[model samples]
Target: MTQGLSTPRLAALASAPPRPAPPPGEAVERCELCAEPVRDGHRHLLDLEEGEPLCACGACAVLFDGQAAGGRHYRLVPDRRRELAGFHLDGPLWAGLGVPVDLAFFSVSGTGEVTARYPSPAGALHAAVHAASWRRLAEVNPVLAELRPDVEALVVHRARGAAEHWILPIDDCFRLTALLREHWTGFTGGEAVWRHIDAFFTELKRPGRPPRR
Candidate 1:
Protein backbone atom coordinates (compact mmCIF):
# COMPACT_ATOMS: atom_id res chain seq x y z
CA MET A 1 0.00 0.00 0.00
CA THR A 2 1.23 3.54 -0.82
CA GLN A 3 1.68 5.99 2.04
CA GLY A 4 -0.24 9.28 2.08
CA LEU A 5 1.66 12.35 0.85
CA SER A 6 2.73 14.87 3.49
CA THR A 7 1.18 18.39 3.61
CA PRO A 8 4.49 19.96 2.46
CA ARG A 9 4.65 17.64 -0.58
CA LEU A 10 1.07 18.46 -1.55
CA ALA A 11 1.86 22.16 -1.17
CA ALA A 12 4.88 21.80 -3.51
CA LEU A 13 2.82 20.02 -6.15
CA ALA A 14 0.24 22.80 -6.10
CA SER A 15 2.97 25.34 -6.96
CA ALA A 16 3.47 24.00 -10.49
CA PRO A 17 2.90 26.31 -13.51
CA PRO A 18 -0.60 27.74 -13.53
CA ARG A 19 -2.80 27.64 -16.60
CA PRO A 20 -2.37 30.50 -19.07
CA ALA A 21 -5.07 33.12 -19.16
CA PRO A 22 -7.22 33.50 -22.26
CA PRO A 23 -6.76 36.49 -24.57
CA PRO A 24 -8.84 39.61 -23.94
CA GLY A 25 -11.96 40.46 -25.92
CA GLU A 26 -12.24 42.88 -28.87
CA ALA A 27 -11.78 45.77 -26.43
CA VAL A 28 -8.25 44.50 -25.79
CA GLU A 29 -7.12 44.68 -29.39
CA ARG A 30 -4.31 47.19 -28.72
CA CYS A 31 -3.32 49.81 -26.19
CA GLU A 32 -4.59 53.27 -27.15
CA LEU A 33 -1.55 55.04 -25.80
CA CYS A 34 1.25 52.70 -26.90
CA ALA A 35 -0.50 50.46 -29.39
CA GLU A 36 0.65 47.66 -27.14
CA PRO A 37 -2.23 45.52 -25.78
CA VAL A 38 -5.41 47.43 -25.16
CA ARG A 39 -9.05 46.42 -25.17
CA ASP A 40 -11.00 46.88 -28.41
CA GLY A 41 -12.72 49.97 -27.01
CA HIS A 42 -9.51 51.34 -25.47
CA ARG A 43 -8.81 55.08 -25.62
CA HIS A 44 -6.09 56.62 -27.83
CA LEU A 45 -3.78 59.61 -27.96
CA LEU A 46 -2.06 61.58 -30.70
CA ASP A 47 1.70 61.96 -31.06
CA LEU A 48 1.89 65.54 -32.29
CA GLU A 49 5.49 65.66 -33.34
CA GLU A 50 5.73 62.18 -34.84
CA GLY A 51 2.14 62.22 -36.13
CA GLU A 52 2.07 58.64 -34.96
CA PRO A 53 -0.79 56.77 -33.31
CA LEU A 54 -0.43 56.01 -29.59
CA CYS A 55 -2.47 53.53 -27.60
CA ALA A 56 -3.59 54.85 -24.23
CA CYS A 57 -5.80 53.96 -21.34
CA GLY A 58 -8.39 56.32 -19.87
CA ALA A 59 -6.03 57.77 -17.26
CA CYS A 60 -3.17 58.47 -19.66
CA ALA A 61 -5.55 60.02 -22.15
CA VAL A 62 -7.02 62.32 -19.50
CA LEU A 63 -3.62 63.74 -18.60
CA PHE A 64 -3.27 65.65 -21.87
CA ASP A 65 -6.77 67.03 -22.22
CA GLY A 66 -6.21 70.45 -20.66
CA GLN A 67 -4.83 73.66 -22.18
CA ALA A 68 -2.34 74.14 -19.33
CA ALA A 69 -0.37 71.20 -20.71
CA GLY A 70 0.67 73.34 -23.72
CA GLY A 71 -0.52 70.54 -26.01
CA ARG A 72 2.63 68.48 -26.00
CA HIS A 73 3.29 65.24 -27.80
CA TYR A 74 0.21 63.39 -26.57
CA ARG A 75 -3.39 64.49 -27.08
CA LEU A 76 -6.51 62.43 -26.49
CA VAL A 77 -8.34 61.31 -29.63
CA PRO A 78 -11.77 62.93 -29.75
CA ASP A 79 -14.93 61.02 -30.68
CA ARG A 80 -16.49 63.67 -32.92
CA ARG A 81 -17.56 62.08 -36.23
CA ARG A 82 -19.14 64.37 -38.82
CA GLU A 83 -20.00 64.13 -42.50
CA LEU A 84 -19.45 67.02 -44.98
CA ALA A 85 -22.09 66.52 -47.59
CA GLY A 86 -21.70 69.86 -49.36
CA PHE A 87 -18.00 69.36 -49.98
CA HIS A 88 -17.22 69.19 -53.69
CA LEU A 89 -14.18 68.26 -55.81
CA ASP A 90 -13.90 68.29 -59.57
CA GLY A 91 -12.44 65.32 -61.50
CA PRO A 92 -9.32 67.17 -62.65
CA LEU A 93 -8.50 68.31 -59.13
CA TRP A 94 -9.05 64.78 -57.82
CA ALA A 95 -6.73 63.42 -60.51
CA GLY A 96 -4.06 65.94 -59.54
CA LEU A 97 -3.93 64.51 -56.01
CA GLY A 98 -2.65 61.28 -57.65
CA VAL A 99 -4.39 58.87 -55.27
CA PRO A 100 -4.75 55.52 -57.04
CA VAL A 101 -8.20 54.83 -55.65
CA ASP A 102 -11.32 56.95 -55.43
CA LEU A 103 -11.08 56.84 -51.65
CA ALA A 104 -8.37 58.78 -49.80
CA PHE A 105 -7.64 60.42 -46.44
CA PHE A 106 -5.64 63.60 -45.91
CA SER A 107 -4.04 64.73 -42.66
CA VAL A 108 -1.38 67.07 -41.43
CA SER A 109 1.85 65.21 -40.83
CA GLY A 110 3.94 65.42 -37.67
CA THR A 111 6.24 67.88 -39.39
CA GLY A 112 3.36 70.35 -39.83
CA GLU A 113 2.82 69.25 -43.39
CA VAL A 114 -0.34 67.96 -45.08
CA THR A 115 -0.45 64.52 -46.71
CA ALA A 116 -3.00 62.46 -48.58
CA ARG A 117 -3.00 58.67 -48.58
CA TYR A 118 -5.13 55.83 -49.83
CA PRO A 119 -5.44 52.11 -49.20
CA SER A 120 -3.92 49.78 -51.75
CA PRO A 121 -2.95 46.11 -52.19
CA ALA A 122 0.49 46.74 -50.74
CA GLY A 123 -0.56 49.11 -47.95
CA ALA A 124 -1.51 52.74 -47.41
CA LEU A 125 0.00 54.70 -50.28
CA HIS A 126 0.77 58.42 -50.13
CA ALA A 127 -0.28 60.78 -52.89
CA ALA A 128 1.25 64.07 -53.96
CA VAL A 129 -1.16 66.76 -52.73
CA HIS A 130 -0.56 70.35 -53.68
CA ALA A 131 -1.20 72.82 -50.89
CA ALA A 132 -3.13 75.15 -53.16
CA SER A 133 -5.61 72.42 -54.04
CA TRP A 134 -6.02 71.55 -50.39
CA ARG A 135 -6.68 75.19 -49.64
CA ARG A 136 -9.31 75.26 -52.35
CA LEU A 137 -10.99 72.21 -50.88
CA ALA A 138 -10.81 73.69 -47.43
CA GLU A 139 -12.42 76.88 -48.67
CA VAL A 140 -15.74 75.16 -49.14
CA ASN A 141 -15.37 73.15 -45.97
CA PRO A 142 -13.86 75.25 -43.21
CA VAL A 143 -14.43 72.52 -40.66
CA LEU A 144 -11.70 70.60 -42.43
CA ALA A 145 -9.46 73.62 -41.97
CA GLU A 146 -9.77 73.17 -38.24
CA LEU A 147 -8.61 69.55 -38.26
CA ARG A 148 -6.15 69.03 -35.42
CA PRO A 149 -2.81 68.76 -37.13
CA ASP A 150 -1.62 65.15 -37.28
CA VAL A 151 -4.33 63.61 -35.13
CA GLU A 152 -7.27 64.31 -37.46
CA ALA A 153 -7.89 63.60 -41.13
CA LEU A 154 -10.18 64.59 -43.99
CA VAL A 155 -11.51 61.48 -45.71
CA VAL A 156 -12.84 61.78 -49.26
CA HIS A 157 -14.62 59.17 -51.30
CA ARG A 158 -15.30 59.75 -55.00
CA ALA A 159 -17.04 57.06 -56.99
CA ARG A 160 -19.57 56.77 -59.79
CA GLY A 161 -19.45 60.53 -60.46
CA ALA A 162 -20.35 61.35 -56.87
CA ALA A 163 -18.06 62.46 -54.05
CA GLU A 164 -18.36 62.56 -50.27
CA HIS A 165 -16.09 64.03 -47.63
CA TRP A 166 -15.77 63.57 -43.91
CA ILE A 167 -13.52 64.89 -41.17
CA LEU A 168 -12.39 61.95 -39.05
CA PRO A 169 -9.81 61.13 -36.44
CA ILE A 170 -6.45 59.78 -37.62
CA ASP A 171 -7.08 56.50 -35.81
CA ASP A 172 -10.22 56.03 -37.86
CA CYS A 173 -8.09 56.33 -40.97
CA PHE A 174 -5.84 53.55 -39.64
CA ARG A 175 -8.85 51.38 -38.93
CA LEU A 176 -10.01 51.86 -42.51
CA THR A 177 -6.57 50.98 -43.80
CA ALA A 178 -6.44 47.88 -41.63
CA LEU A 179 -9.84 46.75 -42.87
CA LEU A 180 -8.97 47.26 -46.54
CA ARG A 181 -5.64 45.54 -46.14
CA GLU A 182 -7.37 42.54 -44.62
CA HIS A 183 -10.41 42.28 -46.89
CA TRP A 184 -9.24 43.80 -50.17
CA THR A 185 -9.57 41.55 -53.24
CA GLY A 186 -8.94 42.15 -56.96
CA PHE A 187 -8.09 45.59 -58.32
CA THR A 188 -11.36 47.20 -57.16
CA GLY A 189 -11.15 45.75 -53.64
CA GLY A 190 -14.03 43.29 -54.40
CA GLU A 191 -17.45 43.22 -52.73
CA ALA A 192 -16.41 42.31 -49.21
CA VAL A 193 -14.26 45.37 -48.74
CA TRP A 194 -16.88 47.52 -50.40
CA ARG A 195 -19.53 46.31 -47.98
CA HIS A 196 -17.27 47.05 -45.02
CA ILE A 197 -16.44 50.49 -46.35
CA ASP A 198 -20.09 51.29 -46.92
CA ALA A 199 -20.98 50.30 -43.39
CA PHE A 200 -18.27 52.54 -41.95
CA PHE A 201 -19.36 55.66 -43.86
CA THR A 202 -22.98 55.05 -43.02
CA GLU A 203 -22.32 55.73 -39.34
CA LEU A 204 -20.90 59.22 -39.80
CA LYS A 205 -23.20 62.09 -38.69
CA ARG A 206 -23.59 65.11 -40.91
CA PRO A 207 -21.98 68.34 -39.82
CA GLY A 208 -23.88 71.63 -39.44
CA ARG A 209 -24.24 74.13 -42.29
CA PRO A 210 -21.25 74.28 -44.62
CA PRO A 211 -18.79 77.05 -43.85
CA ARG A 212 -18.65 79.99 -46.24
CA ARG A 213 -16.30 79.69 -49.19
Candidate 2:
Protein backbone atom coordinates (compact mmCIF):
# COMPACT_ATOMS: atom_id res chain seq x y z
CA MET A 1 0.00 0.00 0.00
CA THR A 2 1.17 3.58 -0.74
CA GLN A 3 1.63 5.98 2.13
CA GLY A 4 -0.48 9.21 2.18
CA LEU A 5 1.16 12.61 1.82
CA SER A 6 1.60 14.42 5.18
CA THR A 7 -0.81 17.28 6.12
CA PRO A 8 2.10 19.73 6.55
CA ARG A 9 3.36 19.01 3.02
CA LEU A 10 -0.14 19.52 1.58
CA ALA A 11 -0.53 22.79 3.48
CA ALA A 12 2.83 24.01 2.20
CA LEU A 13 1.87 23.20 -1.37
CA ALA A 14 -1.38 25.10 -1.00
CA SER A 15 0.55 28.24 0.04
CA ALA A 16 2.95 28.18 -2.91
CA PRO A 17 3.74 31.47 -4.54
CA PRO A 18 1.74 32.54 -7.57
CA ARG A 19 3.33 32.61 -10.99
CA PRO A 20 4.75 35.86 -12.31
CA ALA A 21 2.79 37.89 -14.83
CA PRO A 22 3.89 37.90 -18.47
CA PRO A 23 6.28 40.52 -19.81
CA PRO A 24 4.84 43.97 -20.54
CA GLY A 25 4.61 43.46 -24.31
CA GLU A 26 3.11 40.00 -23.93
CA ALA A 27 0.58 40.90 -21.22
CA VAL A 28 -2.93 42.17 -21.83
CA GLU A 29 -3.28 45.33 -19.78
CA ARG A 30 -6.61 46.23 -18.21
CA CYS A 31 -7.71 49.48 -16.68
CA GLU A 32 -7.04 49.58 -12.95
CA LEU A 33 -10.33 51.34 -12.24
CA CYS A 34 -12.84 49.69 -14.61
CA ALA A 35 -11.04 46.49 -15.68
CA GLU A 36 -11.52 47.40 -19.35
CA PRO A 37 -8.90 46.12 -21.71
CA VAL A 38 -6.50 48.94 -22.62
CA ARG A 39 -4.19 48.97 -25.58
CA ASP A 40 -0.41 48.97 -25.26
CA GLY A 41 -0.16 52.77 -25.41
CA HIS A 42 -3.19 53.59 -23.31
CA ARG A 43 -3.48 56.81 -21.34
CA HIS A 44 -2.73 56.90 -17.61
CA LEU A 45 -4.32 58.68 -14.69
CA LEU A 46 -2.39 59.82 -11.68
CA ASP A 47 -3.94 58.73 -8.42
CA LEU A 48 -3.28 61.89 -6.44
CA GLU A 49 -4.30 60.25 -3.20
CA GLU A 50 -1.99 57.30 -3.75
CA GLY A 51 0.84 59.19 -5.51
CA GLU A 52 1.04 56.54 -8.22
CA PRO A 53 0.07 56.19 -11.87
CA LEU A 54 -2.98 54.13 -12.72
CA CYS A 55 -3.75 52.45 -16.04
CA ALA A 56 -7.14 53.72 -17.16
CA CYS A 57 -9.51 53.06 -20.00
CA GLY A 58 -10.44 55.83 -22.40
CA ALA A 59 -13.69 56.57 -20.61
CA CYS A 60 -12.14 56.66 -17.16
CA ALA A 61 -9.32 58.87 -18.35
CA VAL A 62 -11.61 61.45 -19.94
CA LEU A 63 -13.60 61.72 -16.72
CA PHE A 64 -10.54 63.19 -15.04
CA ASP A 65 -9.23 65.40 -17.80
CA GLY A 66 -9.58 68.67 -15.91
CA GLN A 67 -7.54 69.59 -12.87
CA ALA A 68 -10.55 69.52 -10.52
CA ALA A 69 -12.07 66.48 -12.14
CA GLY A 70 -12.69 63.17 -10.36
CA GLY A 71 -13.13 65.01 -7.05
CA ARG A 72 -9.39 65.51 -6.65
CA HIS A 73 -8.76 61.79 -6.40
CA TYR A 74 -7.34 61.26 -9.87
CA ARG A 75 -5.83 63.51 -12.51
CA LEU A 76 -5.56 62.71 -16.21
CA VAL A 77 -1.97 62.79 -17.37
CA PRO A 78 -1.49 64.65 -20.65
CA ASP A 79 0.28 63.17 -23.67
CA ARG A 80 1.94 66.30 -25.01
CA ARG A 81 5.58 66.48 -26.03
CA ARG A 82 7.29 69.73 -27.04
CA GLU A 83 10.94 70.22 -27.78
CA LEU A 84 12.31 73.41 -26.21
CA ALA A 85 14.43 74.46 -29.14
CA GLY A 86 15.36 77.87 -27.75
CA PHE A 87 15.49 77.06 -24.06
CA HIS A 88 18.52 78.40 -22.26
CA LEU A 89 20.33 76.61 -19.43
CA ASP A 90 23.89 77.47 -18.62
CA GLY A 91 26.18 75.34 -16.46
CA PRO A 92 25.55 77.46 -13.38
CA LEU A 93 21.78 77.17 -13.62
CA TRP A 94 22.03 73.44 -14.29
CA ALA A 95 24.32 73.02 -11.29
CA GLY A 96 21.91 74.94 -9.09
CA LEU A 97 19.20 72.37 -9.86
CA GLY A 98 21.36 69.87 -7.92
CA VAL A 99 20.82 66.85 -10.14
CA PRO A 100 23.85 64.53 -10.18
CA VAL A 101 23.14 62.85 -13.47
CA ASP A 102 23.36 64.02 -17.08
CA LEU A 103 19.69 63.16 -17.61
CA ALA A 104 16.89 64.19 -15.27
CA PHE A 105 13.28 65.30 -15.18
CA PHE A 106 11.79 68.10 -13.11
CA SER A 107 8.23 68.38 -11.90
CA VAL A 108 6.27 70.53 -9.52
CA SER A 109 3.87 68.95 -7.06
CA GLY A 110 0.38 70.17 -6.25
CA THR A 111 1.78 71.64 -3.07
CA GLY A 112 4.30 73.73 -5.07
CA GLU A 113 7.30 71.60 -4.22
CA VAL A 114 9.90 71.32 -6.99
CA THR A 115 11.82 68.10 -7.45
CA ALA A 116 14.39 66.72 -9.86
CA ARG A 117 14.44 62.97 -10.48
CA TYR A 118 17.30 61.14 -12.16
CA PRO A 119 17.68 57.49 -12.96
CA SER A 120 20.24 55.13 -11.50
CA PRO A 121 20.97 51.43 -11.70
CA ALA A 122 18.83 50.83 -8.62
CA GLY A 123 15.91 53.09 -9.60
CA ALA A 124 14.78 56.70 -9.76
CA LEU A 125 16.44 58.96 -7.22
CA HIS A 126 14.87 62.25 -6.13
CA ALA A 127 16.54 65.56 -5.43
CA ALA A 128 15.09 68.88 -4.28
CA VAL A 129 15.51 72.09 -6.26
CA HIS A 130 15.12 75.59 -4.94
CA ALA A 131 11.94 77.38 -5.87
CA ALA A 132 13.92 80.44 -6.90
CA SER A 133 15.88 78.41 -9.44
CA TRP A 134 12.72 76.96 -10.90
CA ARG A 135 11.17 80.36 -11.09
CA ARG A 136 14.20 81.73 -12.88
CA LEU A 137 14.09 78.91 -15.39
CA ALA A 138 10.39 79.46 -15.93
CA GLU A 139 10.93 83.16 -16.47
CA VAL A 140 13.30 82.45 -19.32
CA ASN A 141 11.20 79.66 -20.81
CA PRO A 142 7.62 80.88 -20.77
CA VAL A 143 6.37 77.50 -21.93
CA LEU A 144 7.38 76.04 -18.60
CA ALA A 145 4.58 78.07 -17.03
CA GLU A 146 2.07 76.11 -19.12
CA LEU A 147 3.07 72.74 -17.67
CA ARG A 148 0.27 71.22 -15.62
CA PRO A 149 1.46 70.38 -12.17
CA ASP A 150 1.78 66.69 -11.37
CA VAL A 151 1.05 65.67 -14.95
CA GLU A 152 3.81 67.20 -17.08
CA ALA A 153 7.59 67.27 -16.67
CA LEU A 154 10.60 69.14 -18.03
CA VAL A 155 13.07 66.52 -19.20
CA VAL A 156 16.70 67.55 -19.71
CA HIS A 157 19.46 65.60 -21.37
CA ARG A 158 23.05 66.84 -21.48
CA ALA A 159 25.72 64.66 -23.08
CA ARG A 160 29.12 65.60 -24.48
CA GLY A 161 28.32 69.31 -24.20
CA ALA A 162 25.06 68.93 -26.14
CA ALA A 163 21.89 70.03 -24.39
CA GLU A 164 18.36 68.87 -25.17
CA HIS A 165 15.19 69.97 -23.45
CA TRP A 166 11.61 68.84 -23.82
CA ILE A 167 8.31 69.16 -22.05
CA LEU A 168 7.05 65.60 -21.81
CA PRO A 169 4.26 63.73 -20.13
CA ILE A 170 5.06 62.45 -16.65
CA ASP A 171 4.62 58.87 -17.83
CA ASP A 172 7.29 59.42 -20.46
CA CYS A 173 9.72 60.41 -17.76
CA PHE A 174 8.82 57.29 -15.81
CA ARG A 175 9.43 55.20 -18.93
CA LEU A 176 12.88 56.68 -19.33
CA THR A 177 13.70 56.01 -15.72
CA ALA A 178 12.51 52.43 -16.07
CA LEU A 179 14.60 51.93 -19.19
CA LEU A 180 17.75 53.12 -17.45
CA ARG A 181 17.00 51.01 -14.42
CA GLU A 182 16.60 47.89 -16.54
CA HIS A 183 19.48 48.35 -19.02
CA TRP A 184 22.19 50.03 -16.95
CA THR A 185 25.25 47.89 -16.24
CA GLY A 186 28.58 48.56 -14.47
CA PHE A 187 29.78 52.05 -13.57
CA THR A 188 29.72 53.43 -17.13
CA GLY A 189 26.41 51.72 -18.05
CA GLY A 190 28.14 49.80 -20.91
CA GLU A 191 27.66 50.33 -24.66
CA ALA A 192 24.40 48.42 -24.93
CA VAL A 193 22.68 50.73 -22.50
CA TRP A 194 23.99 53.81 -24.32
CA ARG A 195 22.67 52.46 -27.59
CA HIS A 196 19.26 52.02 -26.04
CA ILE A 197 19.46 55.54 -24.66
CA ASP A 198 20.35 56.89 -28.10
CA ALA A 199 17.43 55.04 -29.62
CA PHE A 200 15.08 56.46 -27.02
CA PHE A 201 16.02 60.04 -27.80
CA THR A 202 15.90 59.41 -31.50
CA GLU A 203 12.34 58.22 -31.22
CA LEU A 204 11.42 61.21 -29.10
CA LYS A 205 12.58 63.52 -31.87
CA ARG A 206 9.82 62.20 -34.09
CA PRO A 207 6.29 63.56 -33.97
CA GLY A 208 3.78 62.19 -31.46
CA ARG A 209 0.23 61.13 -32.26
CA PRO A 210 -2.82 62.86 -30.86
CA PRO A 211 -4.22 61.61 -27.56
CA ARG A 212 -6.84 58.89 -27.73
CA ARG A 213 -10.25 59.73 -26.44
lDDT of each: 0.64, 0.74
Give a tens-digit lDDT track for model 1, residues 47-88.
666655566766666676653342666767766666776676
Off by over 4 Å in 1: 1-40, 48-51, 66-72, 160-162, 205-213
- Over the stretch 1-213, how does candidate 2's per-residue lDDT look in tens digits? 112222332233234443555576563678999998887668999777765678888999888778889666888999778889989888888887877678888988888888788756544578778899888888887888888888889999896455779888887776666566657687667777777677777788866653221
lDDT of 1 at 90: 76
> Candidate 1: deviation at residue 124, Å?
2.0
Could you say which candidate leads in TM-score?
2
Error of 2 at 102 (Å): 1.4
Clashes of each: 17, 0
What TM-score, over all chains together, does every model reach? 0.71, 0.81
Residue 180 lDDT, candidate 1, scale 0-100? 67
